[model samples]
Target chain A: MRGAVRALIALGSATAVWLGLLHLLFMADLDDFFGGDSGLRPGAASLAARHVKMWSEPTLKELELKKMRQSNAEWDFMGRTFLVLALANMSLRDPGSADKYVDVIDRIIDETIKIEAEHGVYYFLMPYARERPFMAKSGRSIFVDGEIALMLAARRIVRESDEYATLLEQRLDSMVHQMKDSPVMCSESYPDECWMFCNAVGMAALRMSDVLDGTDHSEFISDWLASIKRNLVDSDTGMLISSFSVDGQAFDGPEGSSIWMVAHCLDLVDPEFARDQYCRARQELGRSVLGFGYAREWPRSWQSPADVDSGPIIPVLEMSAGSSGMAVLGAASFEDREFLLGLMTSLKFAGFPVRRDGELKFCASNQVGDAVLLYAMVQGPVWASVKRRWNEAHVSSVGWVDKSVPVAAAGEL
Target chain B: MRSDFFKLPRIDELLSPRGFLKRAAVLTVVFAVFHVAGLREMTSFLCGMAPMTGGAAKLSALMGLGYVVSYLGFIVIVPILVIASALLLVSSRIWPVKPRV
Candidate 1:
């Protein structure tokens, strides 16, 4: 009996010690591990290296994209958008690799546009997209139009591209026309579904376009923001509703999957509102325990069934892998280093990261997930460029139009 | 016949502290094998994507689940078991039990 008691005590003490050690390790300051804006981060560089290789190698790109498309066709399109944005930021952050990153960005834009041209708008959309006609007579998707335009605008911001300049304006004009036709100044991502995520992205794209070509969309952007504040704010959480109808009736409540990216995009249009939304979201959906952080797909006040966008939610913990991944963007965009550090710790602990030949990829995350993380790591420069150009424009003229360097004379990447 | 307590534990002594060490060692070896075999990449299935472009997704996911389980055991359990075994051994030495007369 005494021997058994001793053994039991040993087991108990061992467990306590192990838990204590884990706590100490996890609690250690991990700022350097996640990387900051000081220089090129190893993880980001490795991730970028893998993406550059993928864009350059069609066979490899198709293989990876095929896996994601098999699950969600939208991921195929989203992966391209996130990668393009990441590369653009990388170009701006590290000019030595600008040409290479610019080359990949242009390729992604060209291929995406070519595919849309050949396969039509429904190609990248989900099957439900074709089940009904769009509310707008134009029958276009803001999801596609906005993201593609954002990609183009991002590339041009990094390095002037006359080809992308023409393409960006055409896409923007068509998208704005569709949005203007709606009562709420919103466009559809699905048949009648006006997603806050896509509209906010559209607004950011428009803002970037104005910065680039000196076009004025301030009134339209402000009107859309007013409409959203008036109609789309969720009563319980004060977050912008995730989905709405053509007339701006809420279809879904505030969702982590949508709100994080929405907040990030809205920062370009309205920083104060964006920050408020982010703060609310951080309170409602974000969680941290034992030095790890994650985001729930929905707040307690707004429970949602796990969808493709939310990915799988771990029960009890209420952790949504999809939302937690995008939360990285929100945290990074807002410069919430404490929360970002905690999230990165959880990512390193659970994300199953693999490094091969100086290229990094997370085994628990697909291409789109990794791309989102990559974009978060290198996000600041593109948005800063837009802000800088807007400031320059304001200082020069009384309007939202800036007298910027011409495309040919715009400094090479 | 009297058996030495410190001798290699017999199969009947599987419940002893040394058994815990043996179990942990086995788990550590298994996790190492899985890691070296490149099964970590298969864990991409956790987020709902096929681990390979053309292979059977279910099979890939099963392999991924195997790696994950072993990995959890390795990271969380192996150390505890080893430490427990070590502590038990130390306690036994400090407070030796007299054999029954």
Candidate 2:
């Protein structure tokens, strides 16, 4: 009887201790893990260290890019764009280190441009992009034009460049013309397919360009917003659909992977609309259970098979790696501290963070994933700077006021 | 301790508190070996990166998965075993068992 009782005690104690620890860990505020003060987050700094090493060493970068390029060339392009965005924010957050960050940013921009020139736009796009001819007369991709413009605009936001300034103007003019020519008021990412994600990013680049060069895209931006609001939104969910055809027919419903980022980009274009979409996405897609937060690739009313953008979806949990990664941006952008904490908990639990020689990388995440996390960690300063400049420039002429930038609540993490 | 590590244990001893500690220690050492061997970097294959430049992608991915499995065991399972062993020892002392008839 005693032996049986002892065995029962052992099993019961084990269960209790295990459950208790997991509860404490998941429920505990992860602010320290995410770090305090915008750019100084220890996690962000470690990720930056790894990226800096990768950019500085050609052999290392070659290996990493080769792997990503093999799976999907789009990752190679996206990895560069996100890292540039992160470095730009980092530069703004820490001005003392701005020069070093700018040097790397220039190298990335120059190299990316060189590659695009040597290879065609299809080089960076997926293989299917070549399956059809571009609908635009210029035969240019807004995916390529928009991201390249954003990269240039992000760089100039930190510090002006005469060369990049001229380049940015050319790209912006070309993109604006293309959007106006399109029936849907948005240019195509793939032939006959317009992604709200890419269009929102293009608008953000336009907004930033207006702030930088004293040009006004407010009217154009408003028209684009109206076009999307009217045509691209899912009627059932009240959230923006992921993609549409040039004639404004919906191709995909509201997707967690696309909407989180689209919501983030929309903030720079239209704040009220951005918040509404974010709230809807939060209601329809975001989830928290046992204190660990994740996002689904599709809402309950809509579902699609997994794609390259959605990554792998966990069955019962319905958690998407790609959407959850981008959800960090949404949570950060809207100051959703509670959701941010939950997502960070899940990331820590499953991201398999390995720190070595003062640098850290999540073994479960690739270069683009880490870069996106880094951007989430240090996003505020650049957006705030852009909004401040835009408001300052437009206050008298456009009758705009400076709204407070979204600040992630300090202790809630 | 080093000399006895390789010796086979009887079933009774394997279930004892000392055996649990031994098992935990063995896991710790093995995880340490994998960590020191730089398998953590290889584990990037989890995100679909081909683990190494010149290596066979399959082999490198397998090694990375091996390290991840070992790491999960070390971090999640080892502590539970250790705590359960300590609890078992305390339970036995508090209510001593009579010898088998």
Candidate 3:
């Protein structure tokens, strides 16, 4: 009996020692993961440069191209957008090596334009696009037109390219005209379908137009702002609705998948409104625990089915791929360093294995997903430059326009 | 007769230390199966996002937690347990005592 007791004591002691050691090791690993001075570091360019070199090789390019072909064509288009935006941001951040990256970006922009012209806008859109005709004439989607125009504008801002300037102006004019014709100042990409994402893109295009042409559309911007504040924004949560009809009736409530990044884009045109939206979104949607951060697809009160926009909702936690990707933009824009780092840590550990060669391809995430991440990492400089110019002009032109009619037609007093 | 009786197999011999190691190995394999099958993704359901598809409804949250714990245990703890058990067995063997008749 005594021997048995001794044996039990010895076993218990050994178990305790092992567990204690394991706990120490686990804490150390976690500390290494979370302990960083800052979240927004300047290493994306180097990472992207490495990817560019890897992609420059014909064999690797062929392999990636083959995989993209098997998947959706939008992936192919989005890949170019991400790389171009990264390159543009890199050019501003680091001019010495900017030209090489700019050349690559220009090539992507040129190629993307060619593809859009050849295959038509339908090529990049989902199959549902064909299910119904667009409400607008010429069937141009604000989604495609706005993003493409932004890509071109970003390129031109980096280096004065006459070729892209013409394209940018044409696209901007079309978007502006579409916004003017709509009774509620909202353009539809589908039959009676308007999306917050597209609208944000349109706003971004307008902001870019203001940047490029020195023109002011403060009236038009303010009018839309008032409309959003009155009709589009959810009163309880202050988050913007994701979709609406042409007549400004809500189609979908505020969605986690869209609101966060839309808020980031909205920051360009209206910082106060954007910050308000972001703060509400963070309170309603963002979650953090045990030093990790994630977001839900919908608020607790609102229920919606899992669609392509949400992208494979994980049961129980309510994590959405789209929301998770967009959360990066929100966290970065708001300067929520802890949340950003936690999310980044989660991404590194969970969301598809990112290999060491800078070839970050998530298993569950498609090309557009990665592009959004790339955009989040490099979005600051472009918005910063635009804001700087706007601030400088504000002091000079105090009596420019009335605050009530923010949405004036381009060049209209 | 007394010596022959003493020659009988011991409990440690019957359940070899190496055999326990093998069981730990089996636990590790099972843990890996569930993890790669994306049972970890189900943990997201706890966050209130609906399941990706209908098939995920079958696994209860308790079952997922059990699988995750067991999986982590097998990968992390089992190896240490096996090593410690092996050391204990070897130590016992090195200091063997004679049974009184």
Best by lDDT: 1
lDDT of 2 by residue, A171-289 (tens): 98999999999887999888988888888889999999999998998889888988888888898999999988888888889998889888888888788889999999999999987
Best candidate (score: DockQ): 1
Query: What is each candidate's fraction of native interface contacts (fnat)?
Result: 0.70, 0.45, 0.03
Instruction: List candidate 1 segments past 4 Å from native.
Output: A1-9, A23-39, A395-413, B1-16, B91-101
Local error of candidate 1 at B33, Å?
Answer: 2.4
* Residue runs of model 2 more than 4 Å from their true location after superposition: A1-13, A23-39, A402-413, B1-30, B53-55, B87-101
lDDT of 1: 0.86
User: Interface RMSD values for the candidates, listed in order?
Assistant: 2.4, 2.7, 9.1
* Model 3 C-alpha lDDT per residue in residues A1-413, reported as the tens digit of each score: 33344344445655666654543332212232222222323344334644476456767655554444443455566567666766777677667878777878877787778878999888777667789888888688877787788788778767877778888889988887887778778787666778887788778768766767777878888888787787787766778888988788888889987898788878877777888888888888887644456787888767887775676676888877678778877887767776677676556534533345534444334445655666667666666666655655653474432122243521243
Model 1: per-residue Cα lDDT over B51-84, one tens digit each: 8765588888888989999998898788888889
- In model 1, pairs of residues that clash are none
Can you tell me the DockQ of model 3? 0.09
lDDT of 1 by residue, A160-206 (tens): 98988999999999998998888888999999999999999999999
lDDT of 2 at A392: 63
Question: Can you give the DockQ of every candidate in the order shown?
Answer: 0.50, 0.38, 0.09
Candidate 3's C-alpha runs over 4 A off are A1-47, A54-72, A357-364, A399-413, B1-24, B27-101
Better of 1 and 3 by TM-score: 1
Candidate 2's TM-score on the B chain: 0.84
